[model samples]
Target: MWTINRFPGLWLLPALLPVILMTVYPIGHALWTSLHEVMILFPGEPFVGLRNYGRVVASNYFQDALRNSLVFTLFAAPSVVILGTLIALFLQRRFFGSHVVRSIVLLPWVLPGAISAVLWVWVFHPSFGILNGIMRDLGLIEDSILWLTNPRTALMAVTFAHVWTQIPFAVVLMMAALSTINSETLEAAAIDCRNPLKRFRYIIFPEIKAMIVVLLVYNALIAFTSYDLVYAMTGGGPGTATTLLSFQIWRESFSMYDFGAGSAVAFIVVVISAALIVAITRALPSDLFAGD
Candidate 1:
């Protein structure tokens, strides 16, 4: 018989090895690369000691990309979480064809990111797009809005698309959270508090508060690191309007052949993601993690 003390973590090596190789090794390599002058055209990878990081930070591109990323995360994360919660609540009601509606709602989540990007591109196309047509019919606008092309609206357009793709996941998680609410408590609240808003505020909100925090953090991270949608939709914009850190990494590494700068940007992204997640968790109520 295999004793626990005799072979500590031996059995776990098989599982842990792959994770170490995949995550640990890449991060280590990126960190190593970031400390050097790793231009692909250069003959040698001379040690630079944070020069790549300094250069990336000093660049206007990095500042613009950072601003855009923050804005995207701010808008997309809350929109996904709030819209998802509301939709999940509406779906909880027993109505005709509710099952079908639930399935349809998950369609966006199931679709590939590239495909979703393509679909949204057509939806937001400047000329002869569905959105423009609808707005025109409603007398909302005299001319089609330049969504992907114009710098002013490009970031918001991408954020809207990201929110759309993310909402199905948020809804699923919120639905599961909502399912855990005690029916008796809900019914009692409904009787005593006829106001729907009051019921949500006092009862429903408390029950799903933990899940809300989780969804917010998760969605924020997704928005912060999102690349495929931006790449496929706007290709980092008419200018640098929609350029995010992830895209910046790609631009430096592949487009500009500056591997050291790319790795530095990648490291910055990792640090930012970690810090944002920590800040969000710390700012929220401690009771979020309380055991029943």
Candidate 2:
């Protein structure tokens, strides 16, 4: 009889079982469905090999969704990082009202995503919402603009909302990372006559580099998987300008009743996000977690 030793290694089996059941099984199921004409919401469909993949690859809707996903990621992730880092850095120092400011910035991260989305929907309302009213009163706009209705500004609006909701998370995370820096090390750099900017450029940035990269990868995955925000905010309208891949997948699966194509889209998104995370992890040296 062979016995498995109980260490941290024994915990791996339970952890892996859930991963296999929830993640691996669904992934395998989606991959299989992508290769066939799956009637997800109905019965009796014929198995068609690779035709769905070919169709999805050539479709303009898929192209548009992919493009929008990339554009949103490009803008939203960095905005959150830079803004969040600034907020974190500012709050790291002791000052009057600093605690209050930090709490205010963390509001979005505490709220439910659905609630935040709905709140923004009202905020951007063309007629009575605060945004347009303020803009109009300040003479920033000639008239109230239908933020979700206009294709040109729809992406920007959604991106802004996403950045707003996401920044709080980045702020707290990077702040925690910033707290781990050695004060003595910073003082040593100061003793060498390094300016504040130079200290950050050398000592500070290097210490938090891993956290920044991880945050980027995490935010990219979140942005790519985003559907609730886009759905509640724009609903993939006023001409599909703000349609993301997740919502597009929902449309294909439910609205269009094309399960095969939708499953393929899901698989592709997961693959792309996974690849990005793996790449970032590889770029970080092994010593990132090593204790001095």
Candidate 3:
């Protein structure tokens, strides 16, 4: 029979085995494939030694996708965080029917991404869409605006859709963090600092600083890896105006059947994501994460 001290490593094998098989193996295979010339059209995956990476790096598609992803992250992450924080603060206040409002606020986030994307597709429709109709009624535009079709607005449209879903998630996290903040601290700050901004800056900000950092990193990652929304809405069309890195990888591997290039892009994405997460973690204030 196995004893506690006798075979500690063996006892850990069960949990470790699943992780190795599921995560470790897939990552290892992807890295190996990226280094080779993998083609479904041809026979064996021949070793190319970074040629796949070089090819993808040189491709115009990769360049466009990278730029689009960056733009999306830049706009969407901030919108999510800002809107979420505001919404959370509003919901945090004591008021009549606040519970109902809080429940309503979660509807967008609770909806499936694909479903939201589909709904936005209709919202962005050139002629019959409600947004265009509303704009026309308000005399904002003489004609309907092709939101997802136009190159200039396509990326922004996708970013808006992503932000819409992300805001709720941010709100939830913000509210949770706000709950952890001591009420007496806020009340004391309220007396000292009459200005709301001053109160937030001095008292509330420090308490929720760690959550904000985490949310930024989370939002950045989600925006960078956006696919379902783009796929459902834009299809990476309008001359690849909204083609993100994740969507490009999907197009390369499944649509184009270039596994080597796809894997190379995937690994690059993983590396960038890891680096961003690390940087965000490091950027957090020392006291933000310090345990008492």
Candidate 4:
């Protein structure tokens, strides 16, 4: 039953070569480039070994950026999962204009992430900005606050924009998972005298645990690799307070002309993302996409 010809698992990998070419080629090239120091867009160019990675490892700035990336990932991932679940659950009900509302929510996710970041950059402008104007109109503030310029609130501000953009994606993904739950079972739960909260906890929640874990991992990866928002908003300004690893990689490669160090940072980010995806997959029960 498990014969090679029967299973066809070996050929399956070759069939994936096109995808591998798209993703793996760049990674492999970068890994090679990371070891050699060279500058193409600058006046002077030279080749060096792992010295770039060594420099990055010793730099306090790189460490700070890595820490900030983790912080953003930690906060953003859980928020997307929990808040998105609530929104999805609410929309799962039959309500007036529920379909229309769901469609509107997905508009953000449909927009290019970089474009979304640019829009928020305008929204966060300090003087005579829309955000501050609204706050003043609502009696929330007397002065416009510099959202992207202030280190204390820069990360939070960027995170708010990211969360708003990502929530729709989570809602759509969760709703698909929720739709797979047996409607008869839900109807029975309603008939079984369990309160709404209890019904969710005991019935709906357990069925979606695997999907939740998968989505959490995906959200964490998105937050981990975030670059566009920070690039558009702060450019790692306010003393590198809101700089993530991806932005740091870009700066190192482009601004400082250190491709080797940037490649190392990129490699580390990939490792982090892959490890997280693997861990989440492990935590999920074995029955995902499998019939009981």
Which of the numbered candidates is closest to the native, going by highest TM-score?
A: 1
What lDDT score goes with residue 63 in model 4? 88
Give the Å error, residue 139, model 1.
Answer: 1.4
Please list the C-alpha lDDT of all candidates, in the order they appear. Answer: 0.93, 0.87, 0.90, 0.86
Would you estimate the TM-scores of all the predictions?
Answer: 0.94, 0.89, 0.91, 0.87
Q: What tens-digit string does per-residue lDDT give for candidate 1 at 167-209?
A: 9999999999999999899889989999999889988998888
Any idea how many clashes model 2 has? Answer: 0
Question: Taking the tens digit of each residue's C-alpha lDDT, what string does model 3 give over 39-154?
Answer: 89989988999899999999999899999988888899878999999899889999999999989999998899899999999999998888999999999999899999999999
Rank list by TM-score: 1, 3, 2, 4
Candidate 3 least-lDDT 10 residues: 283-292
* Model 2 residue 121 distance off true place after TM-score fit, in angstroms: 2.0
Q: Runs in model 3 with CA error above 4 Å?
A: 1-18, 282-292
Candidate 1 deviant stretches above 4 angstroms: 1-3, 6-15
In candidate 2, what are the lDDT values of residues 1-292, reduced to their tens digit? 1345535566588889999999899999999988888875767667888888789879898899999998998888878888988889889988999989989999999888788989988989999889998998899998889888999989999999999999999999999999999988877988995587887888888898878887888888888889988998889988779989999899999988989989989988988788868976787778765663
Clash counts for the predictions, in order = 0, 0, 0, 0
Alpha-carbon RMSD to native, per candidate? 1.8, 2.9, 2.3, 3.5
Give candidate 2's TM-score: 0.89
Model 2 stretches astray by more than 4 angstroms:
5-11, 40-42, 188-194, 278-292
Badly placed stretches (over 4 Å) of model 4 are 1-10, 41-49, 137-140, 278-292
Q: Could you give me the TM-score of model 4 versus the true structure?
A: 0.87
The numbered model that scores best in lDDT is 1
Q: In candidate 1, residue 22 scores what lDDT?
A: 99
Per-residue lDDT of model 4, residues 129-149, tens digit only: 689989999999987898988
